[model samples]
Target: MSAGTPERTPTPGQPRRASVPEFGHGMVVGKFYPPHAGHHALIAAAAARCATVTVVVAPSRRESIPLDLRLDWLREVHADTPWVRFVGRYDDHPVDYADPAIWDAHCVVFREAVGPGPVDAVFSSEAYGAELAHRFDAVPVAVDPDRRTVPVSGTAVRADPAGSWRFLSPPVRAWFVRRVVVVGAESTGTTTMAAALAAHYGTSWVPEYGRELTAHKLARLRERSPGASVFDVRWDSDDFRAVVREQQAAEDAAARSSGPLLICDTDARATAVWEERYLGSASPQVRAAARRPALYLLTDDRGVPFDDDGLRDGEHLRSWMTERFRAELAGSGVPVVELTGSHTARLARAVEACDALLAAGWSLADPIATPHTN
Candidate 1:
């Protein structure tokens, strides 16, 4: 099961539903190109009226967002209502409400997932609700015919996700959040830059998990050998793997709660670089853990003085580390913004890069357009 969203006030024009549980099984079908509040409201309304609801989250395989992800988001959002069951199917069949054969092809897929159970009511906010209900031999119930109540659509959201940010649930928001990662050599101010950028954007930032692991290892070493230093801390491929896993987990968690943009001190890609610095070379698994982020802010160690925190012993290797990061990042294909100069200047440059990334609106491929889309 997916994680549940925290209890919060519903978005305006999207009313919360109270489960009265009157009818038998109800059905709701949609592409849910990117499930938003309006979609949630429709599902909620269905769950309210019926003892059980089967939501057919059918989208073409050609669509950008995966069917599994939509099902996950919907399942997580309505977790409180266990009666609402979510199912997915790749309905690549051509959509044409006027065509009876096309409708039959689509209904076959829906019926396959819904099983032989009778559908008492078919709920939808589209023009084809009545026809769909007629085919299912169920009552047609329209939730919101006009766009006034929930004034957002998949087309509008795909066009401008940032503008329709409020309509998205936490899980959906996390999917759309543009992750910006900051990485560099020791004392190059990656953490400072990350936090500064998050502050500037009024969003959440992910702190480096590798550093925390380093501290933990150092502390453990000190317990056995009191005189042990940061250099005495032993590292293996598994340690870097742990760093990569933990870093990504933290980044993903932050993305769920963050605004449109999320800032991070380092990511799995940087963890691979750290692995190379410690071990001879990055392991295959470690290298594979490097998931691409939206942007990377590589802090240049050109003029920045190195401050040796208790866990860091890389002052002498700062230049080498910086160069290695640059080399690795260059081939990763992610947009890199090298921050060099005074702290103030670096922040200004970071902000400019992030702003540009946000300005370039999300590019969600248009789903196969139907005459009446839910």
Candidate 2:
């Protein structure tokens, strides 16, 4: 299992890669926090040797990404491999492999998940694999414990996910989403630009949920009172605040389901503009939920037609709101991508911004701060 464990050696001159555990049924166990490329290589090494392999997905409560989401990533990566299967056990058990008491508890969990089996071999990249395999009555096969085969680690990926994007799976990459928010005054082609970017990138987009809610609420109000005008209805900051929460939830869910990048029609950063127009001032929750985007494309509403959707304050107010959004984003540390000219030109500019963002990634020395201010 380790350097001096009397294990079979790999082929001569190929020290980086390990030989497969030439056995019938192999087992691998790991927390698979984000299921990176190294995890995939480890599973593949086991799959190469055995007729079948069981991958136990162990997750603790303290993980930033939820257990279910991590499991989802594992399933997505290894599901198509005929020889690989997945099992899981989420518990608060200690992960201290060096401690005998902790190892005993882990053995009990592993025994239950593995069930009754000969367990021809146990595969891992840790020194503890020797003891774990001994408990299972199987030979321990260590695969690239030095991590030379796959250089990336889960901790490194978590720290600067965008910089280490190649190691992550598509599903897990969703968690490290470089959210690009297209926001500005109403009728400025925000929806169109967001959709175009998503389509270009072959990913999903988070539509403006607050606007959708506004349309729904207005429709119901009109249904109840047929001849009532906009002044007949009265709403408060609490209503918009609730909409911000919904928008945030929608964006989070979309991020889970989307690809490497998530395109947002608008996020909490723009909720202030809406709240200010209707409710005098923005809600505190809006600033709280606002996140720093990888890139913010502020639509100028230049040559675009200004049409009211029954909820807007008309074109006359669009310029002022645009200025307000610009002011709100001016001092924020997030990178801004100003869009002008035709729709095609705007889309091109947005695509260019995303390409640059993904290419450069976040520098360790400086990070854009998500300001929690009005």
RMSD in Å for model 2 = 11.5
> 126-229 in candidate 1: lDDT tens per residue?
98999999999999999877877888778778887777777788899899889989999999999999888877777788999888998999888889999999
Best by lDDT: 1
Clashes per candidate (backbone, < 3 Å): 0, 0
User: Compared with the true structure, what per-residue lDDT tens digits does model 2 show for residues 274-342?
Assistant: 778877888777777777877789999778887866666548877888888898888678988889989
Pairs of colliding residues, candidate 1: none
Global local distance difference test of model 2 = 0.74
CA shift at 329, candidate 2, in angstroms?
Answer: 1.0
- Residue pairs clashing, model 2: none
Candidate 2 stretches greater than 4 Å from native:
1-33, 37-121, 125-138, 141-171, 229-233, 362-374
TM-score of each: 0.90, 0.62
Each candidate's lDDT (Cα)?
0.86, 0.74
Least accurate 10 contiguous residues by lDDT in model 1: 1-10
